[model samples]
Target chain A: MSEDDAVAGPTDDGQLVRVEGFLVRLDLAYEPDGHLWVAPPDGSTGNVRIGLDPLGVETTGTVAHLVVGSVGTRVRRGEPLGSLEAEKFVGPLVAPLTGVIRAVNPALATPRQVVEDPYGTWVAEVLPEAWEEESAQLVRGADRLPAWFADEVRRFRLEGVLAQ
Target chain B: MGPEALLETPARPGSRGSRRAGRTLGTLRVLDFGAVSPVRSQSLWHALACGVGRGSPAALALCRPAQPYVSLGYHRPLADLDLGTCRRRGLPVLRRLVGGGTVYLDPRQLFFQVVVPPDAVPAARSQAVAELLGPARAAFEAAGLPADFDQGELAVAGRKVCGHGAGLVGGAVVVVGNLLERFDAAAAAGVLWAPDAESRRRLAGRMAECVGPDPTWPVDAQAFAEGLVSAYAEAFGVTPEPGGLTPFEERVARRFDRLLGSPAFLCGPGGQSETQLTERRRAEIWTVKVRAGVVEARVVLDSTVLRAALVGGRLRDVVVEDPEGDQDPGVATALEGVTEGSPALEALARGGPSAARAAAAAARLLARARGGGE
Candidate 1:
């Protein structure tokens, strides 16, 4: 999955509220990490629009191999959605919500797309039954961006990237 | 019962009931991943350790490292290893969470691990020690493999064929052991303590190392692992459900990645260095055997410059030959009862001072031989 796909942007928190199949945030700028995240233009049931908060990309090192589950398979919330093999080690791609796998980006199978166009690469799109419950766990909007990113960075030692 | 089918408990940091409710537990979950080589074994050990540590359910994994290697306790010093020997022999040195002396492992050996909660038994201390050392004896007895535990050493006949160790973390205990099936004795020899080396060589020479050297034992790797899993499951009455790494375990893996990335934890003692080493190295440990009518003397030398000999069953002589060549007259009486034909002779052959050094350069030799170093 792309860096952009790991945590998409928070457009208008209003639109990003809970949807049935998936959640969509149309117009928010900035995440707790200060990265600008946005949703994809496609209006698919499984794929949600996602973009990274600016600082999110800077904190996490360059993307490596992206491991997405078999497309079109059923998944549960918090299941190992897959993994993002970072430059250092394989980082997890946690499931946002329980749903059936609808689609995944073909670019992930090849290592280059992750590095060349991480923002454009879409990981996996799940059509969730409860979007609000899942999105509630994700950080949305500019104010929450920094803290969310900081917590993860501190916990995973993403600060290793910052040091580099 | 394949490796992929092994079930792992919930990994998302939640109660077991919430994640897995009434999943039909298998009678025996055999995770046969063929023979995973050493490099892969390291990773599997990490993954298994992390899984068990986080209550990710019980599992049995079998793998063989591609090359020969030695793994020391977490706090063991790299200096303890003869790096030149390891490199020349194409062996790698690794550090593991388990506490014990260094071990030599290869594909010829079968690695078995038991991941379970500490409460599996009533008495934690005896239970912890028995889990690895005891089960092997039972399994071998059942399979007619001739196994016994001689003072925590899992020996076949009179020679040790298994080296076991355990690591307790986060309320979960992981016991790992290796069955030396058809390994290179010479290569493996370089990894043992000189004391153990002498013991092994004597035992091998007597053909007493293994009571039944069953080269054609019906128990293959998969069958042996499955038997152990089933034996343990039956003994513990746990119906294992096959599972895989949970999402939370992956998160834990991320945490592990961060931890391993730090050289301090991997390299240094992280503050428990001295305590761990001191605890592991016991002094003047005596394993007595009435059958042999001899007290197996294990003297962990703490200081240098003393030519200490286990003549017969006692400290036969202590000669210190330094700038001040001083011979402790008390040593002759200390060696009073020890005889020439005891196991002490074997220890002397392997670790005792040479005749010339025993008489002339006693102090320097004693100093160098302190700590019973390999």
Candidate 2:
């Protein structure tokens, strides 16, 4: 499919794009290196929800357990938000933006929902402290996302993470 | 902290090592610490991993524990192990920063840990584990074991020889595995919390079949370390240089030594909360993973008790008992070879109500082992 065809326009809820069978939400800004997404602020709370992107969930294997940072803890960009343990692998979940954790998802107790619905299952909600500065480092916008995402799929495939 | 501060040994004037000093760019530092205390064997590598962004070189660490101990994965539930038994046996239980289930460790196993900057490996966690463990597999093969890397574990002829765990610690990616010269299956099974003697015996039997190297193969610890260093040096396109821990790494190690020994860390993320304890008491079902795709479980419901072993998603060696001391031999025979969640399990209902209840409970136990339910 052409890049334009791969990306669908924004819906009433959000915009989504399909790249190499992996879903990418264009409305959310992403920390490309960490494979995490930050949703726009909630209407009333001004808190942004953060979660693993689809590619992140796929690459990490089936997440068996999760330990998210407790509510009210402050984190700097690139700092550990928490850790995730898959069947064969384990690693940290990095903060996508500088923020204080306003709340942690209850779904972490049983991580099946997080693995099954990466985009929909937010891991934590944060009140971002420096969105204007840090958001520039993130990947967003329809014009930029498709190419970056396609490149990522190609890279993971080359690295033997995805099927050839 | 300059690059010199990170050097294991200070470069001296007119010394033969002088020209090759100062970070030794493109060189893999080899830290060969002979046998160490059980806790140091783990904390040393963790310290190096934490130093990745702070000028720690790409390195390999080799050591064996001077004493036997039991280790739990970072996220594993503390209830998986029987602390009372461990204490009675004088075995120290530790929790590692890496991920995997609980494992029994001792001096017979030689540990090799590779720590590198995260960018040096694939961003994909599975791919990273496989790539990092490639050299260990090679080392095993060089020892004439015909080792294979299957899904992040090293096995010989379908029996696992190397149990591996990997994770990102600080700015570094660390993958740790062991070359098992010998494994005491009964001792390994002793640390786990089993419901009774029969279930523990079954677990021991399964562990003997799945883990450890073939006893006939002789493993020389020095030769294995040399082979590992050579393989890693070749893979990373770097020369091997003998080194020691940097000052920064020493501080980190000291800090980790205390943290890893603390009660809070040993309890891990799955510490026994009151709710979990109550739920476990209510369910009275426990499952322990024997290895990849193998699980042994014990379930107690009402007056009935069931002990089962599941290998490769198929039931095996099922034993059921009731208060009346009566168990239909047909229940065991009928469930034999049945895959988990098969309609055949429900078909046991035709045998009798008690048989049906046992079959249903067995199915749930299998489901829990498969990570489908709690």
| Candidate with the greatest DockQ versus the true structure | 2
Cα distance off (Å), candidate 2, residue A137: 4.5
TM-scores for chain A, candidates in order?
0.57, 0.90
Give the DockQ (2 decimals) of all models.
Answer: 0.01, 0.40
Q: Residues A23-90, candidate 1: write the lDDT tens digits.
A: 33434422232222434324544456333333344333444334555666776654445543222122
lDDT of 2 by residue, A1-164 (tens): 57566555545556776777788888888877667888888889989999988877777777877877668888777666777776555666667789899998988777888778899899999999988898888889877887798787776676666776
Scanning candidate 2 chain B in windows of ten residues, the lowest lDDT window is: B9-18
By lDDT, the best candidate is 2
Model 1 lDDT on a 0 to 1 scale:
0.45
What is candidate 1's lDDT per residue for B128-195, written digit by digit as tens?
45653566566555544566766556665455556566544333455677766664555544544333
Name the 10 consecutive residues with the lowest summed lDDT in model 1 chain B.
B1-10
- How close to the true structure is residue B15 of candidate 2, measured as C-alpha lDDT? 11
